[model samples]
Target: MTATTTPNSHTATGERADLLTALAKQRHFLRFTTRDLTDEQAGLRTTASALCLGGLVKHVTSVERIWADFIVDGPSAMPDFTAWTEADLARRADEFRMLPGETLAGVLAEYAEVARRTDDLVTALPDLGATQPLPKAPWFEADAEWSARRVLMHVVAETAQHAGHADIIRESLDGAKSMG
Candidate 1:
């Protein structure tokens, strides 16, 4: 189903629009902090942690893929996490390190791709109340009884949470500041 914008949606600009604002804000924060860093600086962990800008991109991409595919697009295999276990321990152990060959551009682009696809699903599905089984949130009253509306809200919520995470990582990259 297609999403129709309403005349009374000036405040939030519709549900999807409101959510997109959060996504864009988060994306913007991530982009600016790592804007001109070389591949080296992109993954550099200044503090005693592994929470670098590049890794944050990777982390956000993983998150969008999960919510968009599982929560918004029904069931599907998450491609990003296929080999994650191998790098999982390393990333988890440290809060600010970049993996080999990891680039800010590449990871951000992938995240953008996932965000677009998620937007498509949200706009196409008319019934927010039409629920699907989200593997991550397995206890959500079962898949058959799930509502599209709830899933949409959940996606935004999840994105917002990660956006906070990204914000912290962004500040750590440099003395950069963000407001939104």
Candidate 2:
């Protein structure tokens, strides 16, 4: 099919459109899991896992933003996980919980904004084949490089994985399932 114009006026065809569609579907599932949840419920730990609904959204948002930056700026865009201090670890832990004064609406809004920027980047990037070396981290192989396409796929995977987590958490919280 020829490149089709999206409602947002972005033209994406083939692989780009496929990536956007997959990411959007996963994002919808993730957000849907939080429907009608109050801040208290969104913050509640529904299972043994430390993840909460709002925190999952927050974590996914951070992951998407960081990976999108990596696609644009190479290894320099990521944090030095190998050199994280205790404070850094603590702050990272906080991303999995809803801290005081945080609301579910606020978390979802930030996630929506990040998703918009990522979708925009996918639509605007000239080449999906644009590659960047991976950052130094224990979880990543040294000298590995990822194309923009690969980064986007990773983002979709992460979002989908967390969406599943959110589904379970939501079910535990109130027996509401994203899908029956």
Candidate 3:
């Protein structure tokens, strides 16, 4: 699928460095995806499911935190949205929507913070060939095993998918051009 690319694309290394390509591509995807949301639009839930830009972002963030913990650190427990209903979803929605006491500025500010954090993790753990046991997870001890490489792919996939969602949601909110 052709995606909306960011204007200031991050640097890519090597001719066939799959990891580099995924990281750069996903980073740009994120930048362009969240380019158009207003404080209100970020929080708006206008459809039947009423998915809002903010809700998606928050979901992505939480998901990233959880996965990063697993990859860079170890599997960390976080909220499971699958077990949630509208009210639970709405509460997450509010995280994106800048309430009277909220600020969209902070959410936007996170663009760089997240980038830096993920970049550090990628740079530090450039090798993905090793497999580690998830000690806390009993099920992982059996048939469930993943390599560092697979974990990296998972992060790229997760970010890239959400970035796509952000692109569409942002476009619906405003006619602003994504830096593609």
Candidate 4:
């Protein structure tokens, strides 16, 4: 939950260690950016975008959970979008906006659990080179395959990118910057 060492610590010897460490470092930065924010503060739309600290936490958790599922079951394991109801669509859209009754603490706790699950999978995966086709998505190349290692790197990138977004939002909130 806490990243005590640098991201390089993850790569001391093996690729798995490197990926996990990078993921952990990104998670740590994300958490650190939200430190001291109240539920209201975290939910505030400090920037023009719908992004908020709590929402960022929720989004990252969802991303990790889905990707972890893919790691275990391959692309066929992804959710069927055609079957999604209006409520489901709305919920997915709202994943980046902390709504009523949501608390930063609760969101952070959930994210932590998701992170734990991902870490466990990273350790348990028999082979990082095991490949799977990318799920249908606009951002993904059609029918492209991704190795397990690539998926881990993708998760790390997603977390780090969102960490930057959170840092910006937090700075706007109270001038509390995660980086100097």
Candidate 5:
């Protein structure tokens, strides 16, 4: 699709259309960071941080999926963070590292699918004004609420932030840059 093409170009327009466009642009950059790298290269921790290209893909996929679910089903739909066991928490913390058998190709495909679903949700939701209480997470303020639009913006921010992280990781891996 052209840069002018909004998210869900078949139907989206106005602010929602613009938001979709921004989100897509972030996703594009994130994918660009992973291009032309082998599985081994993609999994290399080029920096002191544990982050790798494949892990970033997995992370962004998880973030978008969770927020998209919130946009559709509200706070209760989110995973019960308080209920997570130590092992579950450890696994969640390790999402930014490539696990055995997790190929770059597979992770990228999953990320793309999540992006598509998020775009579809943006197009299908009748009300961007729909609000959901924020879950009781340490990062979130107490009793906070977010509209669907806010959730979309959050996804955009999350994707964009991680894309920058991925760009640095990719550059460190082989001196490749996602931008000119």
Candidate 6:
């Protein structure tokens, strides 16, 4: 669904606004890391880690989209991590790289679209207290349920963390810093 901005130019208020604002700030920092960089530069790994600026953007976009779906559709929205096939693992790994013909602009555009959808969901959800069962994954506790509020918080945290990673990668690439 297309995202709608409120008359006040804010999609939410109170806690939801706070969450969206935090997410937006992190998204800005993450995108800023790729400013003026060519596709090759964005895809280049500057540090020992495999992460690159464009790849981080793509990965975070996927993460935010998945968690937003989880908020709406429960654990069914997620993949069965325990039963992932080789192809599934390979596909997941591919999320962290800009493969041939994947431009940085394309990645950023997709990320923006996903962010808009997530913001719309946050604004339209009737209850921030709505809960859903967490997907079964090695990293998640078995049978735990998370409220929509918690899910949004997790998204914010993940974006912030990846923005930091992107910042490091950017600095190492060409000595560009997202912030002082």
Candidate with top TM-score is 2
TM-score for candidate 5, residues paired by index: 0.93
Please give the range of 10 consecutive residues that has the lowest summed lDDT in model 2: 1-10
Q: Model 6: residues >4 Å from true position, as ranges?
A: 1-10
Give residue 15's error in model 3 in angstroms.
Answer: 9.3
Q: What TM-score, computed on C-alpha atoms, does each candidate reach? A: 0.67, 0.96, 0.66, 0.88, 0.93, 0.94
What lDDT score goes with residue 156 in model 3?
77
Candidate 2 regions with alpha-carbon error over 4 angstroms: 1-7
RMSD of 2: 1.4
Worst lDDT run of 10 residues, candidate 1, spans: 1-10
* TM-score-better candidate, 1 vs 3: 1
The candidate, 3 or 5, that scores higher on TM-score is 5
Q: lDDT tens digits, residues 1-180, model 6?
A: 233353246557777778777888898999999999999999999999988888899999999999999999999999999899999989988899999999999999999899888888888899999999988899999899999999999999999999999999999998989999
After best superposition, candidate 2 residue 32: deviation in angstroms?
Answer: 0.3
Q: Which tens-of-lDDT digit does each residue in 98-135 have in candidate 4?
A: 88999999999999888877877777688999999887
Task: Report clashes for each candidate as comma-separated counts.
Answer: 16, 0, 1, 2, 0, 0
> TM-score of the candidate numbered 1?
0.67
On residues 35-154, what C-alpha lDDT tens digit does candidate 1 reach at each position? 667887777766565566677667766766766666545655433333457577665544344666666677767777876676666655665566565443334434444466665566
**What does candidate 2's lDDT look like per residue over 38-80, in tens digits?**
8999999989999999999999999999999999998898999
lDDT of each: 0.60, 0.92, 0.59, 0.85, 0.87, 0.90
Error of 4 at 170 (Å): 0.4
Sequence-dependent TM-score of model 2: 0.96
Ranked by lDDT from best down, the candidates are 2, 6, 5, 4, 1, 3
